[model samples]
Target: MNNPDSLTNHFLIAMPNLADENFARSVTLICEHSEEGCMGIVINRLTDLHLCDIFDQLGITPDKASHANDVVYLGGPVQSNRGFVLHEPLGKWESTLSVTDRFGVSTSRDILEAIAENRGPEKFIVALGYAGWGVGQLEREITENSWLSGPANQDIIFNLPLEQRWKAAAQLVGVDLTTLSSEAGHA
Candidate 1:
């Protein structure tokens, strides 16, 4: 079993039994990784806030009302006050983290402006925070089977609806999450 790249730009779908308050049933997209630790965003955790809510706070009226329903997500337990966008590469920005060949992260405000203007990346999800692990903490969790990792499917990341992402990612690995049990001590 080879160790997964800390910066693999993939998704970690929590197993059904993952009761951790921070990541249960969450889908995290790895952003940056090194021997020191790892950082990522939870793609499926929708927040009570919406893009319009942020736009209002910024004094920017959206060009159209179509974005009114956009839901901001609680990306992770870290940096809950910050905003980050994990999106498809549509237009370049001053700050962007290429998680994988297909996924990228842009934290700069310009991207958000573009989104408010109705001209942002083709596909994106707005998140309020991000998930992080210190040094070997992630490796320990994986060894303990708290999560099931796999290559990210672009469609699942961008196209699938929120509630379905977990099962969709699980299916990518050919396991039915519903059949997964939380008992780790079982043989």
Candidate 2:
């Protein structure tokens, strides 16, 4: 569960000036946020791997309905070897973190098995790793203008082309990322 004011179900848009290689111009979906910590999945960066490759690793045979060729994403820098499935409709799964009534994240093998059989959630994206911040860390970075937070938009996550996501997420909050100066200065 998240606090009412928490960023749990929001999009974390990295400001243009954020030069970190893993997060530059990235859009992350905050899945779990509370006094304990914050965890998110970066939606805009793609890895060279595909879903079938992962199935092979897990020894799950892909069925015809399995969209095994779909590209996988680099969710974040943490747990880079583990797989996560970010899906809509919040279906019942063995191990799922319900981000919201409509969205959930599943790390259990059962969801992956269902996906391999094409019996998984209708809308989903597979990701490896996840972005994480310790207690109060994300807030401090946000105060420093490293990110812009806004309500999560499903279209951007499951529909839009990758190149357009960064701008689209920021646009949802009426922040024209293009107009912001990239230079950071502190008084």
Candidate 3:
């Protein structure tokens, strides 16, 4: 969207009061946003599954080296069975939604294959499913103080430890989430 405030390439830091299990204490990377909806991945939520599990399930080989890469994140609740690969320095892929010139979310096997062999982008995060919001839903949630959003930070997504992302993302915009009430106010 041409709208300057479109949250594409931003982070949605869940507010303290939002108790939805899927979103509570989550830091979601908004990769694509439009009049239709918004699609993002929960960058900080870890699942029992790992990249090796994905490689095995897909019959990909040379996965032994991936032992150091237990980096599969629980992206969100929708399409839980599918995989989305978020990476930087957007490269060509079979099915990638280019988030920014510097970022992309790919759902193609080729990207995975390249990654398996160390021929992929410098950094990547394999996520299961994704967080989605229909038109106006996310905006309304923000209006209700369910989330605090700001421009996406690469370090927070790819470099920082998962446990720190929620607060770190919020800090990008100068909000100290620890000081916020877990209760919403009503006039």
Best by TM-score: 2
Give the top-scoring candidate (lDDT). 2
In candidate 2, what are the lDDT values of residues 1-187, reduced to their tens digit? Answer: 3377799999999998999999999999999998899999999999999999999999999998788999999999999999999998899999899988898999999988888888889899999999999999999999999999999999999999999999999999999998999777789
Q: Which residue pairs in model 3 clash with each other? A: none
Model 2's lDDT to the true fold?
0.94
Order of quality (lDDT)? 2, 3, 1
Stretches of candidate 1 off by over 4 Å are 1-4, 185-187
TM-score of candidate 3 against the unseen true structure: 0.94
Q: Is candidate 2 or candidate 3 better by TM-score?
A: 2
Instruction: Report the alpha-carbon TM-score of model 2 versus the true structure.
Output: 0.96
Clashes of 2: 0
Lowest summed-lDDT stretch of 10 residues in model 3? 62-71
lDDT of all predictions, in order shown? 0.83, 0.94, 0.89
lDDT of 3 by residue, 22-112 (tens): 9999999998888899999999988898777888899988445643366688999999988998998799999989888888999999998
Steric clash pairs (candidate 2): none
- Cα displacement (angstroms), candidate 2, residue 106, comes to 0.2
- lDDT tens readout by residue for model 1, 52-168: 898888787778744756889899999898989888873578788877656688888898888888788888988998999998888889989988888777798788998999999
**Poorly placed runs, candidate 2 (over 4 Å):** 184-187
lDDT score, candidate 1: 0.83
